[model samples]
Target: MSLSTVQQVLARIYTDSKLRDDFLTNPDVVGISFGLNCQEIQQLSKLSRQQVDLFARSLKRKRLGEIRKLLPLTNQALGKEFNPLFFQYSETYLPTGNKKHLLDAIAFTKFLLQQLTTDNTQPVSVLDVLRYEAVRLKMFEGKRLLFCNRFYYHLETLINSLHSDSPLIPYPQPNIGIWFRLPNSQWRSLFIPFSVKRKKIFSFHRLVQKYLAIQ
Candidate 1:
C-alpha cells in the first residue's frame, strides 16, 4: 500500500478509540484490513500500545480544547459535565474539512441537546443557553442571518451568573430574543420580556426597527 494509505490508517486509529482498541488487540488483522503489507503491519505492531494511547488521549484533549473555545457559553454552563460529554461525542463523530472545529461544535451542540432531552434533568436554562450559543456559532459560520427564541429565564442573567460563577436560580421569567447579523457582518441581539403587557397592537417590524434605531 502507499505511504498515504498507512498514514490514513494511523490517523483513523489515533482519532477513533474503538479502532485503536481493535488494532492494539489484533494488529495484523486490522493492518491487513487497511491494506497494509506484512512489513508495515509488523512495524505498526512493534509500536508501544501505551504510547499510542497517550498520543490518542492528547489528540482528544486538543479537540476538546478547540470545541470548548467554539462553544464557550455552553462549556461554562455545562461545567464538569462538558468534557466527558464532548469526549463521548468525539468518539462517534470525527469532523473533517477546513471548518472542522465549527462542524465539531455544531455536531456536539446537537448531541448535547439530544442528551439533555433524554435525561431531562438538566435545568431548562441549560437548553436555552445551549440553543443561543448554537445560534451564535451558526451565525459566525454564516449559516444563519436571523434567529429567534423564547427563553424561560432571563438570558443575560443566566449568562452573567455562569461567567461570575454565581449560583444559578432559574426563576421563571419568559423572554424573547432576536439575534441577527448586521450589514457590516457584526452580530447583535435584542431581548424583550415576554410578560411585557403592551396596550397597542404588537408589530414585530416596528419592534425590530425601534430596537435597531436605539442601537
Candidate 2:
C-alpha cells in the first residue's frame, strides 16, 4: 500500500520472466490501458493500423487467464483508477531505436510512475535508467577511455573532473566497442558488459542532486 512497497512490486514485475514473456507474446496485453490513442500507439509502435489490428487479434481469452495468475501476487498497487490518457501517453511513446523516442519513453515512464506512487524520496525513475543508458552509450577518445580496466586510471581523472557539480555523472569511460550511427539516425554502441547493482541507482541519484545543486 505504501510507495516503497509499490516500487518493490513494480521492480519485481520488471524482473519477472513470466510477466515479460506474457507481455511480449500476448496481443491483448498490448492495447489495454496504454494511455495512447490508436493512431498514436500505431505511430509509437512503428506498426501500421493493419499490424496493430492483427496484433490485437492475438489476445485471446486464454492469454488473459495467464495474466490473471500474476495479478493477485501484487495487491494491484497500480490502483483501480486507471486513466485511458495515461496509457495513451505510455503506449504512444513506446521504446524504439530512435533516440528521441527512447528518451521520451524513459521520461514518460518516470512521470507515470511518479504520478502513481506520489513519493519523492526514492526518486529512481525511468529517467535514471535513461541517464545511465545515455552515459553508457557516450563515447570519449584518447586517455578518457574508462569503461574497462585497460584505462581505469584515466576513469578516475575523468570522474574527478566532474567536480560533483558537472552535468555528467562519473561513469567508467572505457568501453570495448566503437560507436556508430544507425540508418535511423540513432546512435548505437556495442560495448562490454557494464553491470549495475541496486546501489548504483542511489549513487546516480546523488549525482543528479549534486549536479542540480550547482545549477
Candidate 3:
C-alpha cells in the first residue's frame, strides 16, 4: 500500500463523522505495526495457511465485516491518536495481508462473543467486559497503548447489531483467538536509551513505520 493509499483510506474512514468519533472513543480497534514473518503472523493469529488463503480469496467479493477472522494484530503498543484508521488502511491498502486482517477479525469476534456470553446483559454493557478482558489480557501494561474508548463504542455497535431482531450470526469464541507478539531483545533494549516520554513516542512511530514500510 502506498502512502497515498493509506492516507486516502484514512481520509475516507474519518470523513464520516460517526466513524471518526467512534475511532476516537474506541482503542481496541486501534491498529499497530508488526514486522512478524509469515509463520509468526499465522501462529499469533491462530490461523492455518489454508484458512488465510480462503479468507484472501473471499475478501474481494465479501463484505469487509464478513471476513472478520482474517485480520492481523499488533502485540505492540500504540499511542493516543491511533485507532481504526489502522484497520481502514489495512482493508483499503493491504487487503491481501490476510493474517493481519484476521487478527482484527478475531479481536472483533472475541468482543462480540463476550457481549453475548457475559454474566450481565440488562444494560447491554459489552464495553465493561471488553475493558476488563483487555486489562486481564494485558493489552496495555503500564498504561494504555492500543485499545481506546472509540474502539469499545464501535464494537458495542457491532455486537448489538449481531444480536438484533434480524441477526447476522450466532456469536463465536475461540480460546486462543487473541494475538500477541514475542518481544525481541534488540527492540526491547533500544528503549532503555530513551527517557520515559521519549521512549513511548519512539515506540509508537517505530511501530507505525513497520506498517507504513509494507505499504
For model 1, state the Cα shift of residue 8 in Å: 2.5
TM-score of 1: 0.83
Q: What would the TM-scores of all predictions be? A: 0.83, 0.20, 0.22
Candidate 1 runs further than 4 Å off = 182-184, 195-210, 213-215
- Better candidate number, 1 or 2, judged by TM-score: 1
Q: Residues 42-149, candidate 3, lDDT per residue (tens digit)?
A: 333443435534544354335344332222111111112123433343343332244544444445445444543463532223333344344333442323334322
Residues 1-215 of candidate 2 have per-residue lDDT tens digits of: 34454333333223343443443454245433433345533433443445534444343222233322322211122223223323444433323233533344335445544554464432232223223333443322122332221221123333344334333333544323223442446444333323333112223334345535655
Task: Give the least accurate 10-residue stretch of model 2, judged by summed lDDT.
Answer: 70-79
Best by lDDT: 1
lDDT of 2 at 92: 38
TM-score of 3: 0.22
Distance (Å) between predicted and true CA of 82, model 2? 6.1
User: Which has the greatest TM-score?
Assistant: 1
Q: How many backbone overlaps does candidate 3 show? A: 23
lDDT of 1 by residue, 1-215 (tens): 88888988888999998899999999989998988999999988987889999989998999999998988888888889999898888888888889989988998999999998898968998898898888877887886677877777877788888788787656667777788775777777787776645423436687679787998
Instruction: Enumerate clash totals for all models, in the order shown.
Output: 0, 12, 23
